[model samples]
Every structure is written in C-alpha cells, then in structure tokens.
Target: MSRALFRSSLPELGSFSAARLRPTAAVLPFSWTTTTTRSFNSTAPIVEPVSSNNAPNPTASQVRPLALKKSHPAAPPSPIADSVKNLLPFLAAQPGHYITVHIHGFPYLVQEGDQIRLPFRMPGVLPGDVLRLNRASVIGSRDYTMKGSPHIDERVFECRATVLGVESEPLRIKIKKKRRQRRKRQAKSKHRYTILRVSELNIKNLEEAAAE
Candidate 1:
C-alpha cells in the first residue's frame, strides 16, 4: 500500500514540472536584446540633415555700410541782397570819403556826418540809437564808387547809422464843420521828425572780411 501512494505522487510532480517549462519557454532573450538596442539608438546624438550638394560661405565686403549709402540736399540765397550787393562793389573801389546812402522807397539820400530829419517820428528809440540800415536801393561813392544797377547783393555792405534826436514841425490847423448844426471845431496838429546822423557806412573788402 505505501508503494502505490508513492507512484501516484510521482505523476503529479511530473505534470507540475511541464507547466513550469512552458512559462520559461514564453520569455525570449531576443525581446530584451531588441529593447536595449532601441533605447541606446534613441539616446544617441542626431547629425544635421545635409543637401546632396555643398555651397561656399559669404564675405563681409559684399555688405555695404549704411552711412556710405545715405544722401543730402542744398540751400537758398539771402533777402538782404538789395542793400549789400551794390554797396560792396562801390566800397571795394573807394578808399576814403563819405557815401550817400538812399533807402528804398525814400526820396532823401544820406551821407556820413550828415544829419537826416525824417518826415515822421521814429518810434521805440531814444537819443544816440545805433541803427543798422539794412534796406537800401542806392549807395553812391565820391568819384567812382560802384553804384547798384537797381538792387545789390545784401551780403556786401556793413552800413550803420546813429539816431540823434527828434525835431518838430510848425503847427497845422484843420477846421471841422457839421452839415446841419452851426458848430465848428479847429484841430491843431504838429508832427515830430526823427533826426539821424550817419555814423559809419563801411564796406569790408572780400579778402579782408574773409581772412578775419
């Protein structure tokens, strides 16, 4: 009876051994080997993709400086052309002596050391006022100082005069009357004129002015 029980246990043990062998056969060495290779390839550095053909590098000379490529413009003439241009030629020729300077639209002419009694009083000036005479139509010399054709280049002359004092004219009366009423009013008015003495009317030579 003991021998029969031993035989039965031996068969059961063989069946368990076959089941273990089946599980061991399912685990393959190739699977672990392929997984390790895939991981290594993923971690490896990738080379930049290149074209089939190669090209040469560019140089610095081909690019231009922005400053060199930029541009500019021009300018205009001065308005004092009439006063200075004609006076310059005359001044250049003359060595000494006074000149009669005539302002544009004014009938009177003025010379150095001469006094000018204007028709109307000049405003905003006291005695001994130095005025820069900028607007002039004619500038004359003693013997052969150059005269302006009509207008002179304003750049030429450096003529300046000084104000002396104010002079008043005699009183002139104007009588005013109403058409309907028998009433009359007499208005008396006196005008004061500005007196100016020509101080300096100098013309600097081109060479002298430019050199200085």
Candidate 2:
C-alpha cells in the first residue's frame, strides 16, 4: 500500500517522529545515570632485565668467542764466562771477603757480622728469621775483585742475614697555619725500618761447588 493509506490506518503512529524521536542536540527529560571509575596510581609490576657480564646469550650468533691469555716466551740460558771459571778458585781461598748483596733490587755492601738497617719495613718476617741473599754484583777482598755485569751466580758466594727487631723513628709533628688565622693543621708521620744483621758469608770452593 501507499504511505498515505498506511498512515491513515493507524492514528497512534501519527506524528511519532516529531513527538517521540527528539533531535540530536536536544536535552533529555529523565537523568540517564552512568558510573565510571578511573585509577591513577596503578603501575606495571614487571621489571626490565639488565645486561651484564653474567647474562646468558640468546642465540648461537650472539655468543662471543673466548679470550686467549697472552704468555711471555722463555729466554735462553747463558753460559758462564771463561775468566770467572779460572779465577773463582783463587778468590775463594782469600780471607776477609765482602760482597755487595742485593735485596729487592737494592744493593748493600755487607760482610759477616755487619748490622744493616733497611730503609723500609719488611713484611711477614719476625726476629731471628734467616734470609739468604742470592743476588750480588760484586765480591771482593783486600787485593782481588770480581764484578758481575748485572748479577753474579748465586753458587759463587753465599750470604745470609738474620732479622732483628724493627726500629721506629721518633714521632714528628709539624704545625701549619695561615698568616693571620688562628686555625692550624698538624701533619704527623712516623716511619718504621727493619734491622738485619749479616750472619754468614762464604765463598764456595771449586770442588765444593762442583759437587753441589
């Protein structure tokens, strides 16, 4: 049927679009209530992982190669000089010998029964502990002298020292102040030294050295 005939059949549907359906911009009569909640203090509890030396590799392509350690090559041994071999026996027979013994790269000319004060304190050593000095640059007597370019063979001469009590210097205090200020800064320092006495020094004979 036509639209006019259908509208006349029902009077209740007359002018429904103009009365029931409101316009888009028009305000509603009853209150359409709606409850909405918002949260502002919420946070994600998941933590991001940090990269470090102990972290595991994710794939074979990401794996790093192991580092190789570098090592020093060994130096060849040097032969003993001809002059030292011939004169060692003559020097051993002489009496009253003195040797320049080296300890920690510092040389000290000491003989048997000579007391020496080391410039610094030697750690882990107590009184009466014996120390065998192996490095030397010179060994001599009244007339003859034997000198090594850097260090002599340890078998040529034996030198020993005994540790004595430590020696401490007197306490020293220095006061520093400004030209016009009463405030002063005091600097204090105290140093300790190790005392050692050469106990034995012997020049080995050719026969005795050969047997060893």
lDDT at 157, model 2: 83
Predicted candidate 1 versus true structure: per-residue lDDT over 120-185, tens digit per residue: 878888998898876555555665454455654445566677888998989999999989989999
Cand. 1 Cα-lDDT: 0.67
Minimal lDDT window, size 10, model 2: 32-41
Q: What is the TM-score of each candidate against the true structure?
A: 0.48, 0.58
Candidate lDDT scores, in order, read 0.67, 0.80
Clashes of 1: 8
**How many pairs of residues in model 2 come into backbone collision?**
0
For each candidate, how many residue pairs have backbone atoms clashing (under 3 Å)?
8, 0
